[model samples]
Target: MRLLVIMSLFALSLVAARPDASKYPSRYDTVDLDMIVNNKKVLESYLKCVLDEGKCTPEGKELKAHIKEALETYCAKCTEPQKEGTRFVIGHLVKNEKEWWRKLSDKYDPERKYVTKYEAELKSIS
Candidate 1:
């Protein structure tokens, strides 16, 4: 009887250990290097046009806001520094997508293939 009770408790604990699937985005499973790269490219293009122009017109402001929103939506799991790195990339891309996006952005971008790559590395240390 004691063995049975212990077994039951172990099973219960295992059940509780499972992650809550509904809380995470469905895209979590599909995320890959290509998706991140594509998103980054698009984000860079959008921001470069807006910030460098400095007009701050309604349309430019709206584009900046949309880029920020998109970053938050897609990279929600990223850390503060990773997010900041992403912003830096966006800013550089806005300034010079072809020339300095890779150079001026941050070391993190070149070091990793995907945005999550940086996150994974950071999490490993912690």
Candidate 2:
């Protein structure tokens, strides 16, 4: 019984620590871009996961569309502070991904497909 209770607590803690992807509101019309920008990891992971999934699966395509639209909307309404915070997070992603793409571009697309695809959008906030 004690062991069961401890394990339950551990499970709950793990779940609590995980980022909330659902925080990106379901209705795009209702999305609070600032919230997503503040919790940038969720948005970053959504973007990178879609890329990591290689643009083939239906789920990947859906996520790509959602994140792309969300980003577009965010860019339109973002204030300087929001853009600053978001740029900081996205810049980190760009740095890491750029290095990966450079190292593997010949084996990948040689055109730096992922970096090229996201770099402009990500840097637009800067």
Candidate 3:
């Protein structure tokens, strides 16, 4: 009984230790953020999808599925590359695409909790 209890605790610890990171597939990590961000039409489509104003491609759907949790957890599950990509994209939006960023923040970060955490670095980028 004691061994079973110990084993259960260990299993639970492993599950709890790794959260959102495991849930998101690394396949998208190779996606070309530069291509998307540099192309206005492409960016707009993704924005529209995320904002629920348009259709979602498979990748967009995958992003939308995890966006909420990613924000809430401050991307706790994100790998290093994922975190870097987020910073780059968000910096671009916050600096170059204020209106869209505002809409996104309003939708996913209405309280500004996540924004507040990275405000300094994001602002300093440019």
Candidate 4:
């Protein structure tokens, strides 16, 4: 019984430590923009996690990955409103982006490339 209990706790800890990254927006295709945008709580939670300005937890990193997946997806059915809404959310999430840039100054503008490309896409929505 004692051995079983210890093993159970170890298993549980491993499970708890694992990240729960979303599996939607499969690699070959896009997901519904509304599916991500309309889910207000999830969107807010992800934004908060990514923008926390602290050491990122696994969950936060997972959320950022999922958000990136959504943002980069090629949803043909996506509407202008959904795109605008996503841009709005992302803009807020990256509002203090100078800090992010400072952290990545040595990376040769990886963040800038993504942000600038996305900004141009957003600009074409009108």
Question: Which prediction has the highest TM-score against the true structure?
Answer: 3
Q: Model 1, 11-110: lDDT tens per residue? A: 0011111155322222212213123234765333333443353343332343333332233344443333333434433433333343433322232234
Structural similarity to truth (TM-score) of each candidate: 0.25, 0.29, 0.78, 0.32
lDDT of 2: 0.31
Comparing 2 and 3 on lDDT, the stronger one:
3
TM-score between candidate 1 and the true structure:
0.25
Model 1 misses residue 35 by how many Å? 24
User: What's the TM for model 3?
Assistant: 0.78
Ranking by TM-score: 3, 4, 2, 1
Separate clash counts for every candidate? 1, 0, 1, 0
Q: Ranking under lDDT, best-scoring first?
A: 3, 2, 4, 1
Which tens-of-lDDT digit does each residue in 27-92 have in candidate 4? 212223334335655444433444454453443353333343333342122233334444543433
TM-score of 2: 0.29
* Winning model by lDDT: 3
| Model 4 ranges with Cα > 4 A deviation | 1-33, 53-60, 65-113
lDDT of candidate model 4 versus the reference: 0.31
List residue ranges in candidate 3 displaced over 4 A.
1-23, 124-126
lDDT tens digits by residue: candidate 2, 1-126? 000000000000111111445332222222233343345464433334444533323322333333333343443333233333334434544454444233322333355443353358656755
Q: Which candidate would rank higher by TM-score, 2 or 4? A: 4
- Model 4, residue 73: C-alpha shift (Å): 14
